[model samples]
Every structure is written in C-alpha cells, then in structure tokens.
Target: MSGFSRSCAAGLLAGATLLTTAACGSGAAETPPGQGDKPEVVAAFYPLQWLAEQVGGSDVQVTGLTAPGVEPHDLELGIQQVTGIRDAALTVYIKGIQPAVDDAVEAETSFDAATAVTTIPAGEHAGEEGEEHGHAETPYDTHLWLDPNRLATVATKLGERLAAADPAHAQGFKDRAAAAVSALGTLDQEFAKGLSTCKTKTLVTAHEAFGYLADRYQLKQVGITLDPDTEPSPTRISEVAKVAKAEGVTTIFTETLVSPKVAEVLASQVGARTAVLDPLESKPSGDYLSAMRDNLKTLQTALGCTA
Candidate 1:
C-alpha cells in the first residue's frame, strides 16, 4: 500500500480495535452498509459527504457522520456510527480535525482528503482565548474546505478513490469530479474579483474558522474565540473590540450553529453591527457552493467591496 493508504488503514484498525474492546460484552452484530449493488461510502462530515455525493453519484451510497446543525468539532460517534464506518466500502475523512470520527473507523478502504491540499498551521490567529479555557491547540487547521481551490483538489482525489473502490463506475466518477472542480474554479474567480477592490481587508469572526478563507482572499482574519463553543476572555473581547474600532470594521460576524450573543456583545462594544457569516459547518440552507456564494455576499457587503 502507498504511504497515505497505509496511514488510513492504520487509523481505521486502531478505531476498530478500540471499539471491539469497548463493546466486548455486547451481543449485537455490527450494522452493515446499505443493502444494494452500490458501494457504501462513509464521510466524516458535511463537506466530505457533499463531495462524495457529487463524485459517487448513483454508484455509491454516501452517509454523513455529522448531522445538519451539529458542531463537527464536538461530535461523539455512537456505536451504530462506528459500525457504519467499519462496514463501508470506502471512507473519506480529514484526520486530526474530528477525533471521535477518527477513532471509530476501521478504514480498510479509506481516503484522507487533507493529504491532497496545503495546510495552514493551526493556532496562528491572534487573541486565541480557547487555550486558556482548556482547549488544546490543533497542530493544523483542517478547514481546507473553506478555500474552493483546496476543496477542488480534495474532490479530485476523492473521485480517484471512489473510482478505485467501484471500478465499474470509474469514468462516471471522473466526469462528475471534473465538473465539480470546474464549478469550484469559477467560484474561486468570483471571490477573487469580488474582494479585489474591497475598502478594508480585515475579517473579524466569532471563531478562528475563517483562516483558510481569509488566506485565499488575501484578507486578515481576527477571531474572537479560538474554540467555537468557548467564550472569549474579557481581555480577549476587549482586544477584539479595540481592533474592530481601529480597523473601522462595520460588522462583527457570527456563525449559524453557535450562539451570536458573544458577537453581539463585541459588536455593541465596538459600535459595529453583527451579521451571520456562516462557516458552512452546518449549512443553514442550500449546498456548499450556494452557501459559499452567500458568504461572499456577506463579505462583500461588510468589506464594502465593489463587486
């Protein structure tokens, strides 16, 4: 096996071993994948699930571990979910981002999408208050899906994996992945043009989830919280407020899944309004592309971009 494949297999084996030990006394058979001729594919979260659906099409049965509106970071895999992972023909996931999912799969046939793209170092953001609040720093930010180009890379790689798993539909997977990549390319261009002439280049978000997006668009992202669920320290809040005022930021952005109270308070302190700038974690509505475009509109309005 190739290095990547070996690593994935190792992770899956580790997860399966743990599950076996934990459920030693349980007299339940593991639930099998969907009963059909189609290949069963398990995706760790919404973004991977969406990619699998687009690429796998009718040839594969794709299941998402993280539900809509659920925070993937805090996901705890149930026994059934673990069984689903173990039984899948193929599993696609990013390692290190979701520990629970990573520890549940016996990914004999699996793909780690994070390996396909360049990763930004985690904990690079200023005013990170989650560390003080008992959240450990992630070595790398796994939110590569935020950047369309990176996601396109992942889609291409995933297509290759899906094709390998279900060779009969290889051509179909390739075709769909190409189309998806093309769409992502267009979206990337749109973001480039839209933010090219923005009045301000700073983005202040509720959490440090927008680093990839900011890097892609050449804007600076200041996160109010390091962890989405943790509240920022009083000093951190004050620091963010001062930065907002100094930058003349018109809005402080919050996400859909998390409460906006913190953002509201920060915006109030800085005399700025609060707006929803979804990270596409739960996808309040629409697919990934539409949600990203909606985010583009929000960013354009807040940054006063010409496009």
Candidate 2:
C-alpha cells in the first residue's frame, strides 16, 4: 500500500482507539461529535467546500482539506486530514485532481463532485504544435469550478447528496441549493453580457485552468505554462508569444496561488501587461459568487469587453 493509504489505515486505527476510550468513559480521549449534531463533511478543496457550505447552510460542519492560497494540484494529505475523511459523515472531492485525496475518498463513502458535471478535456492550445498543457497524466480538465453553470450543477447535486445524508434537513438543503443555482444563473447572464462585445476574443493565462471559462465566454485561452510548477520551454514561450501577437492579447493573466514570473516574462516579451484571472481554487476576498463577479470585472478590463 502507498504512504497515504497507510496513513489512512493508521487513522482508522486511531479512530478505533477513540471509540474504545469513549466506551471506557474516558472523556479526555473521546472525539467530540460534530457541532450541534450537524453532519460532518470533508471537502477535498476550496470549491467543493464552498458548495457544501452553501448547500448545507447551518446544518453541516464542513472541513476543507486544502488550505487557502495553496496549489490544489499539489496537495498532499496529512494524518489529521486523513482522519477527518475517515470519520466524516460525507466526503466531497473531485476525482483525479488530488491523487492522495482520491485514494482516501475511495476508502470511504464519498460524493464524487466530478460526476455531477460534464468535464472538458485537457490539451495543448489548438494549432500550437508540440505544446502539451495539463497536469501530470490527468486527461480530463478538472477545473470545472471556473465555469459558473457547471458549478451550479455541482451545487444542485451536492444538495441531493446532503439531503440523503441528513434527511431531517432535506428541505433546507434543497432550498439553499435552489437559491445558489439562481444566483449562479444571474452570474452567467452577467458574464454573457459583459463579454459579448470585446475588442479581443483571446485570453492569455499563466496556466490552462480556464478552458471551461473561455468556452463559456466564447474566448480563447493561451496558457504560458501548461503546469503551474514547471516553467515553459523556450520554444513553448515563443509559440505563446506568437499567439498573443496574432490574437491582439493585451493582458497576460496570473493566478494568486502560483508564481507570476512566467506570466510576467510572457507579457514583457509581447509588450502586454499582466492581470489577475483567478481560477477560484482558493477563496479570495469573499465567497464564490463575489469572487466570480470580481473575475468578471478583471476580464472586462483586460479583454476590453463591454456590456
């Protein structure tokens, strides 16, 4: 078994110890129940955590496995996080995004969020020869949260799972999910109107995490680096520069969690400025909807898009 699996198994053993302690009436060693009898949920990442909180409202105690400002693609689960997964009433995760989390969730009853929405394929920019952009061996695009409609779909499905887990709060979960869906619909409309008339239809980003958003807004995303941690080769940089010049891309966008060096280098080469186009992998200033609206303003300004 892998190290993560061993950790999870150890966590199970620890849980058993806690149970034994509880039976022996040693309150000091007992694990407390979820707050106010709320069902505990382990969310693999920020987007999933946000969805659970929105759908579950006051009825669920959600623990996010991935911390803010960390690269979700590079998360490695620790013993505490593994224990959280082993003991959660429900675990929510995107399959293939984090391998350790995937293995941990497999050992438990989980709501695979990826199944709730259709996934886009990860690939190099079309017409860019020899430029492959994607996570290590991850064939499907895992950044579904970048698109508001798909995220809304996830919220709806999460509501169903939450209702199933906590039947007494079924109506509350459904109502909150409906409200979230309506809000996402409004955000979608806003994006559609804002990007309808843009001077440039192409967006140059630091990584390939915005394909779904580009598809939704009818814009093309040219990524400077396929993997966030690895630097692009000189040839790949040349190719992206060529695309930027050809597409009249005025801004090269970088994310909060990853370094902006690659984006800055590309922007300098193409005489363009760099901007922030967050993938919403981590909560920025506010909640998911507010961060998306903030992204809309950035997109409008960078792409010269107008309503």
- Residue 29, candidate 2: how far off, in angstroms? 22
lDDT of 1 by residue, 60-101 (tens): 667666667667776666565465466556778888767766
Best by TM-score: 1
Task: Report the Cα RMSD per candidate.
Answer: 5.6, 7.0
State each model's CA lDDT, in order: 0.75, 0.75
lDDT value, candidate 1, whole model? 0.75
Model 2 lDDT per residue over 147-204, tens place:
9899899989988877765677889999999998998899999999998999998988
Off by over 4 Å in 1: 1-35, 125-128, 131-138
- By summed lDDT, the worst window of 10 consecutive residues in model 2 runs over 21-30
**How displaced is residue 131 in candidate 2, in Å?**
12
* Clash list (residue pairs), candidate 2: none
TM-score of the candidate numbered 2?
A: 0.85
Residue 245, model 2, lDDT: 92
